[model samples]
Target: MSESLTIVGIAGSLRAQSYNRQLLAAAGELLPNDVRFILADISNVPLYNEDLESALPEAVVTLKQTVESADGVIFATPEYNGSIPGVLKNVIDWLTRPRGQSSLNGKPAGIIGGTTGMFGAVNAQMHLRHILPLLNMYVIPQPLVLISQIQNKLDAAGHLTDETSQKFLQQHLDRLVSVARRMKNEQ
Candidate 1:
């Protein structure tokens, strides 16, 4: 049997009740036995600084190591002003540092997010999709997991209550694992 795939999940929002974080929790619960979903804490990742590249912050170093060792990455972002939030962008910047030596190079990534708005963070997801390739990350192209009107769909415990949404999320995660394995084989 093939070894299990490790997928690191990062939620862009730092809010205690962020819909994005709730969506990540649901995804974690939905992961299959062959796939593991690890939630990464980006709340303490400091702002990017060129000076720190020589001696990266402990948080940055840990973030890079975690992602570099993972088989795939999942970004759960909340849109702010039609784009990704500053905190999430900061994390990305730190990971993309040292240019061609980024940890995301050739790694598979999936985007999932939740928002109160009707569009469900589509704009932010698109922006992220555009950025991941620049860092040499392979992004899953199908089954976009965008949760809209999340307030009505999630339970008090922050779990996805809609059956259809749960099914789709599971499908997307399965696809992510498959793609990640394929990429690993190619490398």
Candidate 2:
């Protein structure tokens, strides 16, 4: 087995009880021993501004450094009107600053999300699938974790109680680990 991989997980919602946040918490429980999952704080990251690029906010700088140092990233997004939330996109914009020299460039990423809607956050994830590549991120292709009706799937402690969700999350993490390792090797 290869060495442990450090993954930074970003939850897109700022709600106190966001399903996406709970989903990421559950993912941490399912991760393998050889993986370390760290949740990035996007709540404090201000809106992206080109004028502030040269003097980025402390939060943005910390977020960028964390992502740049990680072996992989996991985006837990919340859909709004069949699209990704603006805050999530804003964070990505910050990471993509300095144009072709984005911190996310060439990084491996896994997209997952939860919602009460029947289709889950598929629309949001699809948007990210297209967008991450533009920032030069290599996203995992299989085992997409579009957790639908998430309110019933998680417990009071934010643990994913559904068996199917657990299985899919495990599969997604497995692929992320393999892909991250492969990308690191090629780097």
Q: Considering every candidate listed, which one attains the maximal TM-score?
A: 2
Give the total clashing residue pairs for model 2: 0
lDDT of 1 by residue, 1-187 (tens): 7677889999999998888888998898888788777899887788899999889999999999999889999999888999999999899899888777688888889998878888889999999999999888889887888888888999999989988778778888888889987877777
Task: Write down the TM-score of every candidate.
Answer: 0.95, 0.96
For model 1, where is the 10-residue window of minimal lDDT?
97-106
Backbone clash total for model 1 is: 0
Q: Compared with the true structure, what per-residue lDDT tens digits does model 2 show for residues 1-187? A: 6877889999989899999988988887778878888989888898888998778899998999999999999999989999999999999999988666588988899999989988879999999999998878889998889889999999998999999988999999889888898888887
Error of 2 at 141 (Å): 1.0
Q: Highest lDDT among the candidates is held by which one?
A: 2
Show where candidate 1 strays beyond 4 Å.
none
Q: What TM-score does prediction 2 earn?
A: 0.96
